[model samples]
Target: MKNRSVLVSGASIAGPTLAYWLSRYGFDVTVVERAPALRPGGQAVDFKGAVHRTVLERMGVYDEICRRSTGATDMVLVDAHGNERARISGDFTGGDVEILRGDLAAILYEAGAGHCAYRFGDSISTLRETEGGIEVEFENGPAGNFDLVFGADGIHSRVRRLAFGPDEHFVRHRGYYYAIAGEPPHREQSDGPRRRESYAHNDAGRLAVGSGAKAQQMYLFAAPEMHFTDEAEKRRVLTEKFTGMGWQVPEMLAELPVLDDFYLDALARVRMPSYVAGRVALVGDSAYGNTLAGFGTGLAVVGAYVLAGELAASEGEHIVAFARYDRIMRRYAKVGLGSSPGPFLAPKTTYGLWLRDRFLGSRWFGLMEKFAGDAKDDLDLSGYPAWEAR
Candidate 1:
């Protein structure tokens, strides 16, 4: 096949997944990640509906993923007095199956590692399109030319910026921010009966949820667009936003400084007219990502499958394959653009919070769940028999 040498940016979900399929289809694949190693223990991500299941089964990682599954835990919403006001089923939030982001990444990496070259602690600094291929310069490694380059980096994707335009052109802040932090001391008790149920406490515009043992904590709050230069700054901002709140909020903030896995970012979405620019293309979040939208992981896995299948079917003609991938993915990825989870999780007004509680306690929430399931399955997945793994 022509254009068989491919470079995928990012070692997270999308990059490794694309690498797996491309290598399986007889392409030389290289994956570059900025982190020095595979990041461990991230917030849980889920895969729902038949489309996601089909891709996982095709990749032959379904059983293993199921083995590692973090069974869905119902989220109970409470007030300042720790009174339960409403409950959101795990079936609604966690999808069919939920697993830590790090675990999922590890699985995808292991499946593809045997056939792909993984370059950790490095990232692409520049991309130059040439007659023969795209010349890629790494932050800490030797430059190389690849027949095709893909950006699965993330919403702040370096490849997207270099190949497309700046972040302002595509990434739009969704008027909120989120943070994930874990207290290692309590992790041992994570599987305990109390920890099996997640609890959320909301005060006006802010929401704090913790696995009962305080092992993992997720905080969402409404905020204007802002930037933090370091983890200290992020921690400070989180403290400032969530301090003096009730129902374990004070305790969760107190553990923030000692938590090793603190992560904070804007709940943003990437909008683009296309996923391809000449020899360069983007997949996953770099293509269609809405932070915490609940469909990103599934979209990434499926997008990789389709991109690789198209390339193999077209005999590695990137122009033809890229266009086809873009068309199919854009349609399937629309689910990412439907709504932002911030306002839903952390409402800005007391009335909004009350309305959310009422909604969750009512029958309308069931209809909404059905709608989300339908959206997840709304794709005519094309099969590439010729590219099936031996």
Candidate 2:
């Protein structure tokens, strides 16, 4: 087997997925995650574009995701009193398949573990770039040398800071904050609430409920317009904002006090002008986390595909592979991010929300259909030059 030792940071969607492709290409791969184990039931994330779907198919886990998808049929724009002014369909709002982040993580972990070496409850402490490669210090295991190290870690990547610099130099907060925790839907849900009536359940402690789709799992959170100077401050702010919102919001907040990953700062997009430096390269949210526009998940997978393919095509020449990967991947990323997930996440103002609600009533729903088709074509992987694995 051709084994060019590679050390990857982060074990989320990107890192493990990258490990899958690299191992397929006969590379010695090791992944490190800060979390002790795979986190369960995080916010629901989805795959819309074709490239993402392609990656899942390639990994042989797409079918599993389809089975686990929270097929929430509808959503209501609700008021405190539970009055629904507008509603959106799940297939229309999410993608062809939408699964909880934890479920997706589980699928990836199952596919990747045997093929790649994984180190949990640890991270890279320091990195020194050199002529042959970079010297890395681990927070847990013994330090070692590798031909290449990747920062597939999420938006708040330690590899990015160690290799590049502080996050302030890269992340762009899109003017919002959010927090979430798993809970039981107060009103009980089969497909989602048929009608919109929102209120606090005294014992159930659910807000505006209908299990996401299955009614088996639920979550609640509050997002306000605020700028978090750093990740630490972001969690603190969430703690403050959600400490007492009543209903299920308070419960989610209460849970936040104990867990580590429960409270995520508002949506922030990682914007790096370039993703490569010498022998090292960054992928996933570490490089261009267009969380604001296309919801980083698909973009990360597409990037992983292109990166591993380019590396294999170039026979592990770092510079050539990274440049080609960036050239092809960035354009698609720009197109999708430019499409704007911001509006869907949090409208800028009341007027903007009103406009969105107005559009929901229009037969222009076909616009979304056309948009989805165009997006699928845009994510087409056949356009990429495939590499013959050694």
Candidate 2 collision pairs: 82-198, 177-266
lDDT of 1 by residue, 338-362 (tens): 7899889999999999899899988
lDDT of 2 by residue, 305-346 (tens): 788887887778878888998787777666445543545534
Which candidate ranks first by TM-score, i.e. highest? 1
Go through the candidates in order and give each one's C-alpha lDDT: 0.89, 0.68
The model with the greatest lDDT is 1
List clash counts for every candidate, in order: 0, 2
Q: How many clashes (backbone atoms < 3 Å, residues ≥3 apart in a chain or on different chains) does model 2 have?
A: 2
